[model samples]
Target: MSHSLSMPASCRASLRTSFAMSGALVATALLLPLTAHADQQSSETPAASGETASYDTTDESPRSAYLSDWYNQNVTVIGSKDIRFGPQKIDDIYLEYEFFGRKGPLDLYGYIDMPKFFGIGNAADSGAFDGGSPIFAEIKPRLSLNELSGRDLSLGPISEWYLAANWIYDWGHNSDNRQNTLYTGLGTDIDTGSPLGMSFNFYGKYQWENYGAENENSWDGYRAQLEYNYPLASFDNGASLFYAGFTNYDFGSDLGDGDSTRTNEAVVATNAFVYSFTHLRFLAVARYFHNGGQWNDGSELNFGDGDFRVRSTGWGYYLGVGWQF
Candidate 1:
């Protein structure tokens, strides 16, 4: 009995030691990535360096400043959907959600961002614009329809190469309407947050000839941009500012009558407001995009059947507030 009792104590000691070793190994394992990110966040770009870093916080919520990325890496599948609210406008309403699983040095995730929904003013089909007007009386059912989108691996902590595309066509809610768009791209993370950590994204979108056939609006274009983020103390939220310059090269013969290359420049003012109840975040963004050699004044405004169909420069902007999980 004495010998058996001694063996149990020995086994317990071995188990305890194993657990201790396991903990130390885990802590050691976590150290590498943390150092990697700090190296980016703590310093500015070296005079000899070229680009910023690509990485987000991976620690789960209940986040603290000590947590890497400040816990921005969402292990949950969170995203949003949006649609046009009126004619002459490209935004309507949006939504978001999230999912979970964890991988090594990375978290598994998925998301969606849609920008169109149904409404009585023929939101999805017509060039219906409120024209800075107000609706006094309403008797119809305010219509609404949601859209779906897959995750954009274009920018995240654990993304490799990303590819995405979307095309939309709906005529049920209005008349003489045609619209289609396609988008896809590749990106990488550059961890240079120190002096000016910026990320690079090269994406292309093919918007078809809408309500016109002169190839007046068909083009294969890509946007190359850099973004910078800053954390402010005012709201327990981070305030990030960014600027992106985009260009599109036309493919069809419309260039014969107009410009062939289109350019867009934009600046961003942003803040992600976290809520106390549902734990969801509200993202407020303001951006201004200018289309070089593009006219948005005719029936063919941006894609309308107007005179500026040939690549000409035009300008517009949007202030949006949406949520993410």
Candidate 2:
């Protein structure tokens, strides 16, 4: 049966609210390629002989101390469906403009997405021209603590520390369809002593306008994230095969209202494979969501006709073709 027809009206409304607030995660999938590329390139760049290591003295160095900078911009088409996080699943296809870079003390990543760009989705979807939110964007920035303090705070196996923040915004026509969220905390890059690169971050979440969800306008949960990137292979033509991914675990949130349908914890993990070159790229991603959007798995929502079981745990897939600039 169609989710639109089978879902109770109230549950449907809650589902919309949850999906609107959580849509920022969709933009997150766009981050892997650029992040992996930037890190890989920076790591492979040759350093000058006798260069002062970043972990040297506590003296405040110039803004260009490290002297390595890299960035990439790309546009991609992405599609996914049947990944549940609410009363039903949301199917969406979006056009994405993404950018990421590292310069001086800053590491930054961001993207903008136009949902339903191809006018393909289920009834729950709001097309770009339709009443749904037209644009969703997310920005993540990390400032090196070592750079800012002019000190090398690297511990064993930890190469760098950062003050990291993420902000998400959805430009919808009304407050009920809009979302604004922030995550702030500490982050670090790990030294694996091999080709594999890893990063970890922990954040406290603050919710602003969450599509009228109960958690709106308050401090909500905490999230722990881990990311990894590896260069699987490189070709003579400069095209390369790369593997990258991230995992997020969210906990300690109280959405108010206290409905049995929702929980305080959720998790999502994603893996990506990219075949990239200077001018073009191809990407495939697989993701797993458990208790997505904090919706309880196997919980029943009772309405007029019968009870419907929520399906919030499952696998989601994304495919994209991109042009790098």
Report lDDT (CA) for all predictions: 0.23, 0.61
* Tens digit of per-residue lDDT, candidate 2, span 92-151: 777887665556777666677787889988875775688777787777777889899999
Let me know the TM-score candidate 1 reaches against the reference structure.
0.37
Instruction: Evaluate residue 126 in candidate 1 and report its C-alpha lDDT on the 0 to 100 scale.
Output: 22
> Which pairs in model 2 have colliding backbones?
none
Q: What is the lDDT for 252 in model 2? A: 89
Q: Which stretches of candidate 1 lie above 4 Å from their native place? A: 1-178, 183-185, 195-197, 203-213, 216-219, 234-278, 292-325
Question: Cα miss at 176, model 1 (Å)?
Answer: 6.4
Instruction: TM-score each candidate.
Output: 0.37, 0.78
Measure candidate 2: CA RMSD.
10.9
Residue 321 alpha-carbon offset, candidate 1, angstroms: 6.5
Q: After superposition, how far is residue 91 of candidate 2 from its true place, in Å?
A: 1.8
Candidate 1, residue 65: how far the Cα is off, in Å = 18
